[model samples]
Target: MCAKNILWIMCDQLRFDYLSCAGHPYLQTPNIDALANRGVRFSRAYVQSPICGPSRMSFYTGRYVRSHGSTWNGVPLRVGEPTLGDHLSEIGVRTALIGKTHMRADTEGMARLGIDPESLIGVQVAQCGFEPYERDDGLHPDGPYAPDPAYDDYLRDRGFGGSNPWEQWANSAQGEDGDILSGWLLAHADKPARVPEAHSETAYMTNRAMAFIREAKADGRPWCAHLSYIKPHWPYIVPAPYHDMYGANQVVPVVRSGREKENPHPLYASYMEERFSRVFARPGVRERVIPAYMGLIRQIDDHVGRLAAFLEEEGLTDSTMIVFTSDHGDYLGDHWLGEKELFHEVSVKIPLIVVDPSRDADATRGTVTDALVEAIDLAPTFLDAFGGKAKPHVLEGRSLLPLLRGSPDWTRRAVISEYDYSQRRARVDHDVPVADCRMTMVFDGRWKLVHVEGMRPMLYDLESDPEEFVDLGDDPACEAERARLLGLMFAWARNPANRITMSEEQIAAAYDTELDANILIGYWDEAEVDAARKARGDAE
Candidate 1:
């Protein structure tokens, strides 16, 4: 079959279990559910890092957080790291970014390399290798950080006048007394945003994606369009009809337990005491905020349906692969945590649905697999779809094409994720040195172990305590399991991931080729070298 176009849709801060197809109780997401029915849904997909920037870097580079070295938000992805666009573009596919990536350019690295930021090559490098159609990270606050001027201009042309229209009209809600309530505050989450449904961030992003696809079709090139939505994130308010669609009664039950706060891990305790966590853990907080979160998701679902219809109308449905996923998930008060810094399933686990249009994927269609998949796998998956072999020396993730084609040999013993908390308040409260403010998690389908630097490692027996309500970090009974998981984590760390300059085949061939090139290090004499040559039939 010929290579097909790719439509990569990623949502910000969307949970794994919030979709109707994922068994969510009341959240009706028919459009996303349709994609799940037409594709393979990975039930146990995890992100490389629970945080946005690092997790997205993993998705773009097909490498781990540590491998990419962009450990947190605002950390620049090093200039030379090959990205998904770089890989796909090499094979003549048009790669474009229409929304959020949270990518910070490595300006210092670029200066050191003498690459001008405004140059054509440098612009591509700064954008993590994609040709940016409209790059907006979507956190357009008024002060300190510059607002997204493009979005602001669009809103102004439509008559929303303000110094910061995004924060004023789009993200704020109207109070009963005719006051503006900022959506950044959780109390205003129940109110509808001032912007109309058609001009909200989610809708605007979907329109931009459709526009990119139209231009790509006109140009007659196979394209990989990354349509990233910046919704269902914080400042959790949706516009118009969506905000009122769900109420406190529709909110799912919070997944936290009081026992978790009793003598919790020092790191976990610090996170629980954080402002966001404490506020979300309040008696009626989830009921107030989650409905709005769900509403944002519902808006996204509607837009997905619209985009799908557009594809069918354009006669591109059969020639495009749709990948629906998220960078990471929101805790929504799970484990007494509000944000996604921990390795709990609610925070690290995300939804992944792949609708490959190829006939070879028919067997796995409409099926759900419990395979341990990572966010990094997507970069290589896109590459494989474009008729490119994964460059194993650079791309750490294995291609999922084999599994999509019904190959049963795809099995993984453990999946790993990392977190760097050097910039978080938890590190400061715990007095952890910058070098030691890190953690790694290893999950082997049954047991989950988190190794925190310079602290007791947390362990969970998912088979017995699937909710992860109890931690066995200090429990003497689980020493063996902890040790085994540590060994696996250590083995994974010991891998020479930076040795990317040579392929495995080149390394194997170097053994004999070096001697043939007269760079013999262990040769005893000319006669010994002659014997070796004759043994290899080189003298014949």
Candidate 2:
């Protein structure tokens, strides 16, 4: 009744609607679609944060960004925060990382506690509690950012010689004049990457995952392989064949309008004026960039087919749970935005397909649910699949196993996401203080409200404006709805997120035993104390 292994596959910046199963008009992801046909696909899954580091930290820790305090990129997850690896490993599962987690070590926290970084406990804390088969964040530019030595060695061994082979060979493209074109420039997006298809980053990560699986099988240990891929993200140039698989004609319609910019929210207008947004809003930017983005996704699908086939060949398919998701979705010019920093559907919503091979999951196979799921839910789901109960005081997310097994009692009223933009240019442009550069979005099934610090809250009636074109933030007509959502946000913010040391049951038990411990402050007489003891069956 429990899965012997878990294969957690997470892609970088993949949108919810990009797969064939998810209603993409032109792009086809047959392998991912097949996975969906074999399991449950959540149609409305949102991450706790839209940014990479905070969102991934939420996914790893099963807690909100505010609770984890890793609110932005390069911010370290505090040393003692329990992650997926930490929880799974406690139950005798080997947790291994094959690729990116975007986790920085809280070295200061460790040093303050006098924990040696080279020690076993410190190593686990530094690596986000996963044994690194290979930990590569996948961005290996020259100069300040050092290339991943292992990936660089792999590239060089394959005869791609350069100071930074990952940047020069894997991410760059050859121009018409045979000049090396950096993938950093959006102009070269339509061209194929200089590296061969097999030597690409996606392929390398896939091979590493398979290698880890094979080793785990030989060792005969139940393992959770976090096969995280770093593609379909930036530097969006795929290898040949895949590069030109989709033309400019295949690109979906841009989901923005001039009306959105007419009287945008102050924060939204500031984001629209940012360089990336302005560049994406240009005449032919999306046409050039989106096809390559689609191509990268197609390549990932192909690799997924390869991985699934490998699992079956190794006789692990029937015992392993395959989970496919992403850190967050990309904006790609939606709402005049180039990146994922806002509360738009295109940015916060991500693809989540779970292929549980257990017999209990068969009834829900090939079904799509409109359940309100969050990124934090995955950690508890994995633990639940392994017959482990989620620690309610520690994990904020409920397990998805009941939903997977067709339990009817599963119900959720709202989902919440947070954003901290203190380090962003918008904060500086608006002259906002660091403490005031935060936003919280609370969405019921029909209405979405964003509470921005030091500003008017943004509201959208998704039932009326599914595209979120109209801002009802300052509209007096929607005052009642806005107030209701504000109340919900306030209640959510008031939750006791830090009360992790004791569960409600434990607290209740402690209260019940307080009088038994003879600390009776309200006792007026000895007869009353005797009656209380007799009632509690503690009379002597």
Candidate 3:
């Protein structure tokens, strides 16, 4: 089969189970669900790392956190690294990215771990070889307060009074876009949608991407466009119509309460409490918040419908390889966490749909695979589809083209996700670093093992406790299972030699000793640093 145009639609912090195709009872993701019905859905898709930047970076590089050395955000992707876009672009595939490239940020807490700050935002989308046709730098749909006087007046019209810039504009309750930060305050009371057409971040980006797609089609180039939307991520915000779409009473609450003590990781319960309670800190808040989040999903679906319609309208449906997924899953109310960067299923699992135009409609269509796949597989998959090859480096992923073509034996037994925060903390109490933490995980088909550097590890039997309520790490009955998982962890640690040992000095030298120790890092800058570090090679 000839290589086809690739369109990867990625949503921010969306849980896999939130889609109707994935058995969600309330979500109205018809477009995504339809794609699932027409193509293949991998039920157990996971990211190489739980965090946003690292996972996205891994997806582009087809490498693990250890291989690419982009364990966190803010680290820059080195210039020469052969990313999916780089490979495809070099070999005649035109690539373009619009919307959120969380690939730009780095993990926040690297300073305390003695990791270089510049290395934090290692590999970014720009380095991955996409020409920046349009970029937002991850700004919200609700514009910042100071920039537009009209927006400031709009905020004042909505009676917003927060000193925080993000706080003032983020509330969806304050405006017609009541699902956002400012709109929330004014949602029921003021009804702020009077002025502008609720410019949804998700919808706007989708429209922009549609325009780009049209242009790409007219340009007559085999294109690869990535549209990464930034919601259902935080401060769960949708527009007027979407915010009211799903009923709170009907929305399933994340099953908590009884599961805390089961596989208790350090600060797990506390983290959940903080995550869930913060949104509802206001009285009767979740009733307003939860529905809006579902609304965002619906909104995403609505725009995706636009793309799907365009695909058919342009007669490109059978010629484009459309893929939909997320950087990671939002806990929503699961374990009370709203954002991602965790080991739990709700935080790690993502909805993945790949529609290969070349496959037989009945053979590769609407099929669901229960394989344990990782985001890293994306790079190799695109490489194969685009007539490129995976780098000879020790990559931890395999291509999915064979599975897309219905290969009977194509499956992954397990997958690994790594995270290293070690820096950003809530606050220092009793002289202990509040936020310093490092974690690694291994999840085979039925069992999962989470290893925290300074805390007791967590082991869960996913079959028996799908919600991950039981921590059977110390349970005598589970000793053999724990030992088995421990062995898996050891194997993962050993598979990548460079990650196993490296002094601070060594890492610094590998980075050309350019990274400073003081900067508060994020994923974008980390990519820049990591790209430089990788280029250093064995010179250090």
Query: How close to the true structure is residue 300 of candidate 2, measured as C-alpha lDDT?
Result: 97
Mark the 10 consecutive residues where model 1 has the least summed lDDT: 140-149
Tell me the lDDT of candidate 1. Answer: 0.89
**Candidate 3 local lDDT, 264-364, one digit each (tens):** 55546545445344564344555665676777788888888989998899888888888999989866555655456778888888889998887543597
* Residue lDDT tens for model 2, 1-540: 999999999999999999999999999999999999999999999999998899999999999988999999988999889899989998999999998888889989999999998898998898889998888887775432124548889999999988888889989999778899999899999999999999999999999999999999999989999998988889878899898999999888989888898878989999998888888999999999999999999999999999999999999999999999999998888899898889999999999999888999889999999999999999999999998866878888988888888988888888999999898787988899998899999999889999999999999999999999999999999999999998988888899489887778888877767686788888899999988888878544
Q: Show where candidate 3 strays beyond 4 Å.
A: 105-127, 140-198, 259-263, 273-283, 360-362, 392-395, 424-436, 497-540
Cα error, residue 34 of model 2, in Å, equals 0.4
Stretches of candidate 2 exceeding 4 Å from the true structure: 141-147, 514-535, 538-540
Which TM-score value belongs to model 2? 0.96
What's the lDDT of the predicted structure labeled candidate 2?
Answer: 0.91
Worst 10 residues of 3 by lDDT: 189-198
Task: Tell how far residue 368 is off in model 1, in angstroms.
Answer: 0.4
Compose the digit string of candidate 1's lDDT tens values, residues 127-185. 98999898877666542222454777889999987877888888999888978899999
Kindly indicate the candidate among 2 and 3 with the higher TM-score. 2
TM-score of 3: 0.78
